[model samples]
Every structure is written in structure tokens, then in C-alpha cells.
Target: MTTPRPVDCWLTDMDGVLVHEETAIPGAAEFIAALRESGRRFLVMTNNSIYTPRDLSARLAASGIDVPEDAIWTSAMATAQFLDDQRPGGSAYVVGEAGLTTALYEVGYTMSERDPDYVVLGETRTYSFEAITKAIRLIEGGARFIATNPDVSGPSQQGTLPATGSVAALITAATGRKPYYVGKPNPLMMRSALNRIDAHSETTVMVGDRMDTDVVSGLEAGLRTILVLTGSTSRARVENFPYRPTRVVESVADIVPLVTEFAPVTGPEY
Candidate 1:
């Protein structure tokens, strides 16, 4: 077997690995502190395209996670980066919150309903039927479709709420155009995050909670993956997936010591 490089960079999911809802998981703050003290390049990543990095930073701070705005990577930002590379100075008919719009604007993208280059869909609190209808019409008129993530639903105090993927499906049913998702489960999200931190996948580790989204994406992106049990997928259920993460721990707390214990993972690669 080839000798693996030392893990010098880290990419982690925000919601499950660090904070669960409004509370910070145990050792999450220390985990960040350890990464910072170790001088490791890292990013706190999320698929929620509703809030910008600054907004997310404040939220994480409130939850006691203290991640910087620039250190956070969101689906909105990845989507913007993707569109900017695909078609610079493009136009879009967006159906998301300020996060998506702001990212697009920062990338020199214009928003319009009149024959826009793309119909970009993202996460929002209140998805407007009127807005979705307009997006469908624009798509039918030859606009490409793009979405932030593939999560069909999100969590809330009230209960499960329909998210971007659900709405994107609605538009697909109407316009026969499936959107290209830019968030978790798509290796592009990992690649974009890697590029944002100027980190190489060979020497980076991706820590997340879900087997499907986090593990699979990191595996495909050529990074070692660590699965935590404090989220959606349980250890017992991990074997259900055809692919696997490099390591599995009870939570981020268990990963604190590994900040300085970098080594190549010898797990079989998919």
C-alpha cells in the first residue's frame, strides 16, 4: 500500500458534527480551538443555503462554536462559485433567501425574470408558490436549472419543513428540467470547499455525521472521512450503505486528540 500523507487540513459539517439545532455538541468548541491551535486549515461546511457566512458565523457563535465567517462554506457560496466558473457574469431567476442572492451578486451574477440564464433554487423559510411558478416559466423558456442541495426536508421547532430539494422537485415536475445540486452528496461541494481553503484532498480529512452525504462525498472527493454518531445515521445503520467512511466515532469529542495525531487512513477506498 502507498504511504498516505499526513492530515494537514480538515473539513467538517456544521449542523451535525458541531451543533445540533441550537445547542453545541460536547467538545465541539474545543475541537475548533484545537484545529486553530494546531494551525490547521479547516472549514465549517453546511448545505443550508438560507444564510450567508457572516450570518452563519453569528449563529454558530451564539451556539458557542466560534467559527469565522470566511471559515464557513455553504451551498449558496459553492453554487455561486460553480456558476461563476460555468458562465461568468450570468443572470439567474433565484428562489432563495439572501444567502443565495448575496453569493450570486458577489460573483457578478444578475437576477432577472426575463429570460435569465438559469433558474436557481435554494433553501428558504417560506417558499413562494408565485416565485416557483415564475421559475418554472423561466425554465420552460430555456433557462438552465440549478439548486443548492438535495435535502428534501429540514428541521425546525414546529417539525419537518419542506426544503430546497422538495421545491426543486416541484419545478422539475412542471418544467421537465432537473436541477444540478451543488451541496452535500455531490463531490463538487467537497471540491469547492477544498479549493476555498487552498487544501489538497490527499492531505485533508472530512468529518461529518451522515453516511450518505458526508461520507460518500468525502470518499468521492479523495479525502479521508470520519463519521460521528451524534447525528442522523447510527453506527448500526452505517453498513446499509455500499460506501463507507474511513473512521467512525461517537462524536466530535473523540476526534479532539487527532488534531495532532495526523496519519494516513488505511481503510479500503471505494
Candidate 2:
């Protein structure tokens, strides 16, 4: 019920906030367009590592929401950036799909099947026992472990499908090594996104559907959090959570009114 202060930037979650599975959420496109016209910076931040920013943008446009390639951030990009800074020149044993592999490769990291310096896990629909076994061996052999995101499952047309967390868990169980998470709910990802906007934590708003990741991460980062009920999170779930968002709305459509209420407009200048 508390009002959120005006923020300079909005970091959004894609899967449930903007679109549900393959369909775009109602009024999502128009809301984004309005925000754009108002000069309020916004970006799509997703834990899904199966697609690159460009791919995500294309998918969004196809789903009826027009977003630029640079306006999207994926766990894959964050993971690659982390690796680039933390483990430069180190070989990675990848068990992810094209997006993850592409990001790692773009960052000058070599992907290998054997004797890797790190084991990177992400969502891969083409997962195989061979891939899992190789990753386990590498981790057991003292390779550093990292997962793109900790999402247990992703929304799919058929329902929720297994995500990178499931694979990361299996690898951890087999190798007894915990992977460093590099996605939402993790401060590292928020920090990276904030850096991109050249904005401070206090001036940023993390808006999304999930409380465990998006809202918690924003709160931890000292950013305002907004919970939209267009995704996996329910109103009852938010009530049960220890922390609360700055504002709770039915969907992104409610954001405009909330923004106007929190920060009233004045007469326009020529």
C-alpha cells in the first residue's frame, strides 16, 4: 500500500511480466511504448539463458511487443560478463544451449568438452547424459562451477519446463560442488544492470512477477520493487513473503497510473 518514489530506470522481467510463455501480456506493448515516450528508461531482464538479447528482442516483437536488441538483458550475458571479469582466459565446459555458448564465446572464453577450467550450466532442451557426465567430471576435477540462473523451471506452452537450476542441482549432487549463480535475486546481476544505465541503486526500480527473485533482488540492491501479478506470482504469495514491494498491481498496465500518482506532472515546455 506504500507509494514508490519516482525512479530513473525500470528493470523488468520478461517471461511473466511482459509475456506469458509465447503470448504477450495485455497492454504490455503499449505500456512500454508510453514509458519510452515519457523518457523513462526500461530494460527487459530475464533469467532465461536460452536466447541472446537479439534473439529475445526478435521473439518479443514476434509476440507483439517491440523491444530493441540492446534493451534486453539475459542471464547468459550477465554470466559471460562475470566470467570475463572473474575467469578471463579460462576454458569453460558448457552444458547450455546456443545463447549461453554464444555469449561465452563472444567474451573470449573457450568452450570445451574435456579438461575445462570451469563448468557452466544453463537451460538446454537438448540435454544429454554425455553432456551432464562431462560437466560432472570437470567439476569433480576441481573446475569452478557456475550456473546462468537459479530458476527451477521456465514457463512453456505445455506448462513449466525444467530450467538451468534443475541441471545445476544435478551437477552439484554428482560432483558435490555448488555453482555460483549469476541471475536475478542475485545482487551481481542487478549491479551489472544498474551499471549499464549509469544509475544508482536508489533511483532504480525492479519490476516483475516473481517475489523470490526479482522483488527480493531489488530490495537487497536498495532499489524500489514493483510486483505485477501477470506472471508466476500470486497475490497470496506476496502476502506470505516477509518483504513487500513498493507497489503491487494487476499488471504492467497499472504502472502508468501509479507513476503519475507518485510523481505528478507539470505543464510541458516547448
Candidate 3:
């Protein structure tokens, strides 16, 4: 067997690996601190497209995980980046919240309903039927479809909430146009996040909780992946999937020491 590549950069999912439904996961703060102190390139990734990075930072801070805005990479930002690269300064009919809108605007995208170039779907607490209807019409009128992520539902303070994938399905059923998703499970999101940090896949490691979204995406992106059993995925469910993460840990707490003691192994060290 070949020796494992030494990890010099890190990409981690925010929801399960760091915070769990408004609460900070065990050792999340320590892991973040270790990353910052290690001088290694690191980014906190999230499929949730509802909040901007700044908003997310504040929310994480409230949970005692003091990650900065620049350190957080959301699906909204990835979607914007993909659109910008595909067609810079293009227009879209968006059906989401401020997070998605702000990212698009920053990337030189215009919001319009009059024959827009694309109909972008994102996550929001309250999805409006009128907005979705307008999106369907625009899509039928020759607009391409795009979405932030494929998560059909997300955890909320009260309970489960319908997310971007669910709404995108509604639009697809109405217009017969499926959206190209730009978030987790779509390796594009992982590549985009890596690009943002100027990190290479060979030296990067992705830490996540969910087997479907986190591990699969990282594996497809050619990054070593770690699956932590502190969120949506359970230890028993991991074996059901054909693909496996590079490493599986009990929780984020188990990963803290790894980061803190990370050292590049060279020559006969293996």
C-alpha cells in the first residue's frame, strides 16, 4: 500500500463537525484554535445557504466556537463562484435569503425576473410560493436552473425544516428543468473551497460528519476525508455506504490531538 499523504491544509464541515443544531460540538473550539495556531490553511464549510459568513460567524461565536467570517465558506459563496466563472455579470432570478443574494451580488450577478439567465435556488426559513412560481415561469422561459445544495431538509431549533433541495424539486416538477447543485456531495463545492484558500487537493484533508455529503464529496475531490460521529451520521450507518472516509473518529474531540501534533512525515518515517 502507498503511504498516506501528509495533510497541510484542512477543510471541515461546520454543522456536524463544529456545531450541532445551535450547540458547539465537543473539542470544536480546540480544533479551530489548533488550526489557527498551526498556521495551516483551513476553512469551515457548510451546506446551509441561509446565512452569510458573517452571520454564521456570529452564530458560531454564540455557541462558543469563535470562527471568523473569512474562515467560513458556505454553499451560497460556492454557488456564486460557480456562476461567476460560468458567466460573469450574468442575471438570475433568485428564490432564497440574504446570504445567497449577497454572495451573488458581490460576484457581479444581477437579480432579475425578466428573462433572467438562471434561476438560482437557495436555502431559506420561509420559502415563498409566489417566488417559486415566478422562478418556475422564468425557468420555462429559457432560464437555466441552479441550486446551492442537495440537502432536502436541515435541522432547526424547533425541528426539521425543508431546505434547498426540497424547494428545487418543486421548481423542477413545475418547469421540467432540473437544477445543477453547487454544494456538498457535488465535488464542485469542495474544489471551490480549496481554490478559495489556494490549497491543493494532495495536501488537504476534509473533516465532516455525514457520510453522503461530507465524506463522498471529499473523496471525489481527491482529498483525504475524516468522518466524525458527532452529528447526522452514526457509527452503525457508516458501513451501509460503499465509499468510506480515510479515517473515522468518535467525535471532534478525537481529532484535536491529531491537528495539534500534525507533522509532515517524510522519507522512511512511514
Please name the candidate that would achieve the greatest TM-score relative to the true structure.
1
* lDDT (Cα, 0-100) at 187 in candidate 1: 99
Per-residue CA lDDT of model 3 for 123-144, tens digit only, reads 9888888998888888888999
Worst 10 residues of 3 by lDDT: 261-270
Better of 2 and 3 by lDDT: 3
Give the Å shift of residue 45 in candidate 1: 0.6
| Predicted candidate 2 versus true structure: per-residue lDDT over 1-270, tens digit per residue | 344345678788887888976789987887778667777777889888888888888889999898898788888999999999987977898888888999999989998876888888988778899989988888888889999999887766677688888888888888888999999889889999888778787667788899999989988898878888988789878778888887788888877664544452121110
Please tell me which predicted candidate would have the highest lDDT against the true structure: 1
- With candidate 1 superimposed using the best TM-score fit, by how many Å does residue 13's alpha carbon deviate from the native? 0.4
Cα lDDT, all candidates = 0.92, 0.83, 0.89
RMSD of each: 1.7, 4.5, 2.7
Order the candidates by lDDT, highest first — what do you get? 1, 3, 2
Ranking by TM-score: 1, 3, 2
Q: Model 1 over residues 1-270: C-alpha lDDT tens digits?
A: 578778889999988899988899999999998898889999999999999999999998998888889899999999999999999999999999999999999999999988899999999998888998899988989999999999999888789999998999899998888999999999999999999999999999999999889989999999999999999899899889998888888999988888856545555432
lDDT of 1: 0.92
Off by over 4 Å in 1: 263-270
Question: Going through the candidates in order, what is the number of backbone clashes in each?
Answer: 0, 0, 0
Tell me the RMSD of model 2 versus the true structure: 4.5
